[model samples]
Target: MQFLGAINFSLPLLASATETADSSMVLAAVLLSLVVIYLASKVGGELSNRFGLPPVLGELVSGVVVGVSVLHLLVFSEGGTDSNLIITFLQGTAGLSPDAAAGVFAAQSEVISVLAELGVIILLFEIGLESNLKDLMAVGIQASVVAVVGVVVPFTAGTVGLMTLFGIDALPAIFAGAALTATSIGITSKVLSELGRLSSREGQIILGAAVIDDVLGIIVLAVVASLAKDGAVDVSKVVYLIISASGFLLGAIALGNFFNKSFVAIADKLKTRGELVIPAFIFAFVMAYLAAAIQLEAILGAFAAGLVLEETDKRKELQKQVIPIADMLVPIFFVTVGAKTDLGVLNPAIPSNREGLIMATFLILVAIFGKVITGFVVFGQPGINRLAIGVGMIPRGEVGLVFLGIGSSIGILSKPLEAAIIMMVILTTFLAPPLLRIVFPDSEAVGVASELILNTSGTPLAVESPTAINSKSNDAANPEATPDGH
Candidate 1:
C-alpha cells in the first residue's frame, strides 16, 4: 500500500514537470525576437554607413521597421484579423490563454529594455575610459569660461523661449534647456581630428570644454531628474543637488585612485586574463547601481566611474576589452529609441501631430543660437576660430538621445514633446558637418590661428604646430560621410 502511494505521488510530479517544461515556448519566442532585432539593426547600420551617416542612424531606422511601427515583431495587436500571426502561433505552442501570451510577450520586451539600459551604461563607461582628466584640467580657465557660458546662455534661451512661446511647463521647459546644453565630445573630437587639428590650441579648448560640458551636463541631468521625480523644483534641492553631485564625483575620483593602486598591486596575483578590465567594469556597474539607488541618473554614475578609472594604468586594457562590448550593445539602445519614436506624430498630414514639427523647428533654432554664443564667451581669445568652436559644439548626438530617452521613459517628456526632441536631435546631428565646413571655410588660416593659446586676458601666444592626428581627411572632399556624425 505504501509502495502504491509512492508511485501515485511520482506520477503526478512527472505529469506536472512535463507540462511545465513544454509550456516554455517563450524560449523560442525570445530567441527569435533577438535574431530579428539584430539582423534589422545590422542592415540599418550598414545602410547608414554607406550613406555617410553614423551607423546609429541606420540602427534607429531599422528598429522602427521591425518594431510596432511596421513589423510588430516586439509588440502585437489585440483581437484583430490582421494581428501578428507570430503571437498567435506562440500562444498555441505554449498552450497559453490570450492574457498569458500577452504577458509573456511584454516580459520579453522588458528584457530587451533592461539590456538597452545596460548598453548605455557600458557606452558611458567606455567614454569615461577614453577621457583624460589631466588633459581636461590643463585648459581650465578658458575651457571653464566657454563651458559655463555655453551652458548658461543656451539653457536660459531654451527655457524662456519654450515657456513664453510654447506654453510648456517650467519642468519640461527646463528639460529642453538641459537637453540643449549637451555637446557631443566624440563628434567634436572626430571633426577636430578630421581637420587635422586635434592637438591645436582651439582643439584643446574644444576638447577641454567638452569634458567640462559632460560633467556639468550630467550634474544638470541629476538635478532635473530630481525635480521631475520628486514633483517639486525647490531652490534648496537644487543647491543640494549641485553640492552632492560635485561631492559624489570628487569622492569617486579620489576613492577610485586608491582602488586602482590596490588592484595594480594584486594584478600579478590574479589568475584571470581580463586584468584591470574586469575590475574596472565591476566598479562602473556598482557606481551606476548606487546612483540609481540614490535617485540620481545611472549615467552620471557611469560617467563618474569612467572619470575615476581615467587615472588607471589599465586604460589600454580596459579600452580593448570594453569597446567591443559597447560597439555591440550601444546600437541596440539607439535602435530601441528609434523604435519608440512614433514617426506618425511628426507627420504633417496628421493634423494633431503637426505641432511636433513646429516644436522641432523652434528647438532647432534655440539649439543653434544657444551653442553659437559660446564662441564669443571667452573674452579676448584672439587666434581662435570662434565660429568653428561654436559649430563644433552643435551636434547633439548620442548623449542628447540618451538624455531624451531617459526623460521620456521616466514620464518627464510627453509623446509630442519626445517626437520634437528626436527631430531636433536628428536635424542638429546631420546638418552640423556641412554647417561647420561652411562656417569655417579657410582651414589653413584656421589651422594657423588654432595653434595659438591665450595665456592671460588679452595676450595671444604662438606655440608649436600641433602634431597631425590620423583623421578622416582621406575623404575630406566627401563631407557627407564625415566620421564626426555621432
Candidate 2:
C-alpha cells in the first residue's frame, strides 16, 4: 500500500510547492491510479500465466485485488458526483466541503471508464482488420444455424427453468435466459488467439456465430425489455429494433466500402504518410458512435470497420497499430469488471441472499448447457474439437453485462436476479479458458506473449502510394465496383 502511494513522480511541479492540492492534484491522482492499475494488471497476469491460465482471468483478478473490492486503494463512493474512489491514499483533501470531492470522484471514474471502453473497441477492431467478409460469409449459413440454436435453446431453457424449477416471474426468467444467449466473442477470441486458433476454420466459425449471436441478442433484449416495461411486446417496435440493429451493420459497411477509395485518395492527397490507421480509427469511432446512436453495441461498429478495411491491403499494418493500444486498455477494462463485482454478495451463508445464491447456481448450470450444445453443430472433421468450440462460446463477456444493466435500468431485473446473472457471467468467464486448455492439449496458448494473434485471412496493410490511391479512385469512378469485390 505504501509502494502504491509512493508514485509521486507524476505530480505536477507547480502543485508540489503549494501548501494545498488543487484540481491538478486530481489529475495527478488519476495518473497515479493508472500506474497502480497497470502494475496490478501485470503482476496478476504474470502469476496467472505461470500457472498456465489465460492472463485475461489474471488481469480481472488483479482488478478485484487492486480495486474497491479488496485493496482499499479505490472504492466507489455512493451518491458522489466526484471521483469513484478516495484519493486520500494518494493526496489528502482536507478542509474541503464533502461536495468538493465529487468532482474528483467523477473525474477519475469517467476517465478510466472511457479508456476501458476504448480498449474493447480496439480489441474488436483488430479482430475485424484480420478478418475478411468472404470467410465470414463462407460460414454465414452455418454460423447462423449455430447462432439461432444458441439463442433459442438457452432462452427456452432459462425461461422454462425459471418459471417451473425456480418459480421466478416470467419477466426475470426471460432476462435470465436472455443473459445466457450471448457467446462473448471478446473472451472466446482471446482464448482462440492464445491457442493460435483465430485463423483456423473452427475459430472462424465460432467468430461468425458469435457476431450473429450479438445481433440476435440485441433484438431479443429489445423485445424482452418491451415485454417487461410495456406489458406487451409490439410487433412494429420489434421490427424497427431489428431493422435499426441490422441496418447499422449493413449500412456502415456499405457506406464505408463505397467511400473507401475516395477517403483513401483524400488522405493520400494530404500525403501524411499515416497509411490506414488514421482512416481506420475514424471509421471505427464514427461507426461505433453511429451504432450506439442507433441502439447497438459500439464494438459492432469497430468490427464492421475492420471488415471494411480488410478489403484493402492495409489490414496487417492497421492491426499492428491497433493491438498495442488494445493490449493496454483491454486489461484495464477486465480489471474494472473484477473490481466492480461485489464479492460480499457471493456468499450463500448470508441468510438474506440465499435465494440469490440458489438462483445464480441454477442460471450458471443452464447457461453452460445452453452454449455447450451449439458446439455440437460442427461438421465431423479431424482436429475440429466440437466440444472445444462449444466451451469457447460459453463466456457471456460484455454482452451479458449490457443485458443486466438494461434490465436494472428498466426496473425489471431485481436484486436477486441481478446477483444470479452476475454470478453466471463471472463463473462462465473464469471457467472457459481453463476448460479450453484441457480440451486443446496441443494448444500453443501458453507461449507467444507479444503475438497479436490476428486473423491470417487477408492481405497485408501497407501504406498506399499516390499511384495506388489514384488506381483505387479510378476503380471507384468506374461503375463496375462489384459488391463481391471481384
Candidate 3:
C-alpha cells in the first residue's frame, strides 16, 4: 500500500513536468515572433530609406513578405498548421482545456485589437501635432468640399461596383467601402515633409481634407459596427451615431480649449526646471481617455489636445517630450501588426473554406480606386493639381490596417479577407511615394498650407494677403492692377 502511494505521487510530479515543458514552448514561440518582427521592421526601414520611399511603406511590405499569403516566414506557415500549433501551445500555457482555448484565443485577440486602436490614435496624434490649424482654415471650404466628394463618390462607386460585379451582400460591400474612406495622413505627411512641400497649399488642402476624412471614417465605422450588431441598417441608430459623433467633436474641442488654458496656468505656476514634460503627457492621456468615454477615438482626443496647445509657448517643449514616447510605442504597434500576418495562406493549393484570390483582388481594387478618383473632384480652383492630391491620399498606413484588423477579429471578415485587406494597404502605401514624386516633381514650388485657423466663434478664416487685396482692387478699379498691384 505504501509503494502504491509513492507511485501515485510520482505520477503527479511527471504530469507537472510535462505541463512546465509546454509552457516553455509557448514562451519560446512568442519570443521568436518578437525577434522576427524586429528584424523585419529594421530591414524594411533601411530599404525604404534607400529607395527614397516612406519607411512605413517598407515596413508594411516586409510584413506582407512575412505574412501568410507570401513567403510563409511566419504566422500561417505550412497551410495554417503552424498557426494552429502556436495557438495550441499558447492555450496550453494558459492552462486551458480545448473548449477554454477558444475563449482564450478570443480574449488574446483583444490585445491585438487594442494595440491597433492605440496605433491609429498615436498616428493621428502625430499628424495633429504637425498640423497647422491656420493652414487648414485657409483651404477649409475647398478642402471640405473635396473631402465630402472624395468620401461620397468612391463610397457610392464601391458600393455599386461590389454589388454589381461580385453580388456580395450589401452590408459587406458597404463595410468594404467604409474601410476605403479613411485617408492615412501619416504617409501623406511623411512624403510631403520629405519633399519639403508640407507647408504648400496643395499639401495643406490634403491635410485638412484628411482630418475631415478621419472624422467621417470614425462615424462610418460606428455606423457599420451598429449595423453588424443589429443585422440590418438602422437609420435611427445612424442618426443617433451622427448626433453623438458631432457632440463628441464639439466636446473634445471645448474640453481641449478649456484644458489648454488651465494646464498652461498650472504649468506656469509649477515653473519646475527641465521643461515640465510630464504635464504634456498627462494632458495627452487625460484627453485621450476623455475622448474614449465620449465614444470618439482616443487619437482624435490626442490630436485635439495637440491642436489646442499648438499656440502655447510650451508647444515645442510638449512636442519634444511626447514625440519620443510616440516614436517608441508606435512602431511596436506596426511591427506587431506585421508579425500577425501569415503570408503563406495565399497559396491557391490550400484546400479550405477560405476565399483567397478573388477576395484579395477585389479588396485591392476597392482600396486603390477609392482614393484615386478623389483627385478629380477639385473645382473652381485653376492652379490646384488634383492628381497629386489624390495620390497623396493613397497610403492606408495605420488607420486602414486598424480597420482591417478590427473587421477580421469580429468575424466580419475571414482570414483570407484580412490578408487581402492587408495587401491593399501595402500596395497603396508602396504606390504613394513614387507616384507623388512623379506628380509633384517641383514639390518646393507647390506652396503647402499648414492649418485652418478658426476664430473664437468657430468660423474658419482665410489668409488674405496685401497682394491679393491690391490685385482685387486693381481688377475692379484699374486694369493695370492685373499686371501690377495698383
lDDT-based ranking: 2, 1, 3
* Candidate 3: residue 164 Cα off by (Å): 1.9
Worst 10 residues of 1 by lDDT: 1-10
Better of 1 and 2 by TM-score: 2
Candidate 1: tens digits of C-alpha lDDT, residues 1-486: 000010011334434433444336556665666677688778986676566544545666787787656776654222112244455667777566676655455444445565666766766566565455564555567787888877888788888988899898889889978888887665455444434444455666776677568667766776787788887656665676566656776787678767777766666567777766777778888998876565455766776687677676766556666766766676666566555544455578865457778888888888887777777776545556777777777877656766675687578776667777877776676556556556645443333332332211112222224332223132223222212222
Estimated TM-score for each candidate: 0.70, 0.82, 0.71
- Clash pairs detected, candidate 1: none
Q: Write the per-residue lDDT of candidate 2 for residues 1-486, one digit (tens) a residue.
A: 000100111224323422233566557666877887788888987787788776767777887787665774544433122234456644354443454455455455555666666767777777787666776776677677778888999889888998998778988888888888877787677666655556555667788888888888877877888888898988887798788877876786687567767766665666565555677788789877877677677888888888887776555566667665666777766776666555666877776468888888888888898888887876543445678768878887656776787787788877788888878877887788788777766444222222233421122211212222224322322232111100
- Enumerate clash totals for all models, in the order shown: 0, 12, 28
Q: Write the per-residue lDDT of candidate 3 for residues 1-486, one digit (tens) a residue.
A: 000010011334434433444444434544545455557777986687577655555666676666554544445221223344445655566554665443333333333334445654555565565556666666788777767776786667766776787676777677666666777765676556545445456677787777677667766777776776677667775677567656765675566555666777888788566445677656667777876676666666677666666656666556556565555455545554454554454566774314646766776676666676776776765656688878877776556655664565566765555555666665666677778877875432222122222211112212222233224221232222111000
lDDT computed for candidate 3 = 0.57
Worst 10 residues of 2 by lDDT: 1-10
Candidate with top TM-score is 2
